[model samples]
Target: MTHNPCLSDMSKRVHRFPLFSITALLHINSTSALMLGRGLTQVTHIKLLLFFQTRHTG
Candidate 1:
């Protein structure tokens, strides 16, 4: 299979600015969660926590 340089480069950028990416993702999820309902909001929070932990460890 041919390698995709563009995808690799994008991944590198994400790893470099994990915080900025996480904040943007959280903002998007928060708005959607508000429209979805309380249950989704809770799920979003848990996902956010897990994301944060993984970012730190991995």
Candidate 2:
């Protein structure tokens, strides 16, 4: 996956920087993070739904 500038910089500074800076960086890149989070949530929900449906029907 490709990262935006804020994410790249956050990765570089993650260990060196304080929590405040990290939070600020996260906010700067919140759009990407939010999208990724929603995508993951949807995938997980779909997988669980499929698993349950198969187990119940089969």
Candidate 3:
């Protein structure tokens, strides 16, 4: 049986949408994770500095 030409193009476009959205989501998640990692590192650095300063003063 011959298929309709209109649905073929439309179906391809529909399939592409999910792939674009998934990659966009990946970019957002990676950026968020990087920011979180940076924040955690800064907090750890501050804690270490404070601990050492207190030890030296005492």
Candidate 4:
């Protein structure tokens, strides 16, 4: 199967600039983060969700 370059690029970008990803997550509201997380990889989605949850609870 052909890999999607856009997804690959995004994965790379996420890895390369993790702080930026965190910052973006912080700026976005929970609903928007949930929607955005749906498109991420399973592990990444979970990680972001946990991070978002912790930010709110802690």
Among all candidates shown, the one with the greatest lDDT: 3
Candidate 2 residue-wise lDDT, 1-58, digit = tens: 7759988788887767789987888787997889999999999999999999999999
> What are the runs in model 2 whose C-alpha is more than 4 Å off?
1-28
Question: Global CA lDDT of candidate 4, please?
Answer: 0.85
lDDT tens readout by residue for model 1, 1-58? 9999999999998789869779999999998877789778889999999999999999
Off by over 4 Å in 4: 20-58
Q: What TM-scores do the predictions have?
A: 0.37, 0.52, 0.68, 0.32
Residue pairs with clashing backbones, model 4: none
Model 3 C-alpha lDDT per residue in residues 1-58, reported as the tens digit of each score: 8999998999998887888788899999999999999999999999999999999998
Better of 1 and 4 by TM-score: 1
RMSD of each: 17.6, 11.9, 6.4, 17.2
- Which pairs of residues have clashing backbones in candidate 3? none
lDDT of 3 at 14: 82
Best by TM-score: 3
lDDT of each: 0.91, 0.89, 0.95, 0.85
- Name the regions of candidate 1 deviating beyond 4 angstroms: 1-36
Q: Residue-pair clashes per candidate, as listed?
A: 0, 0, 0, 0
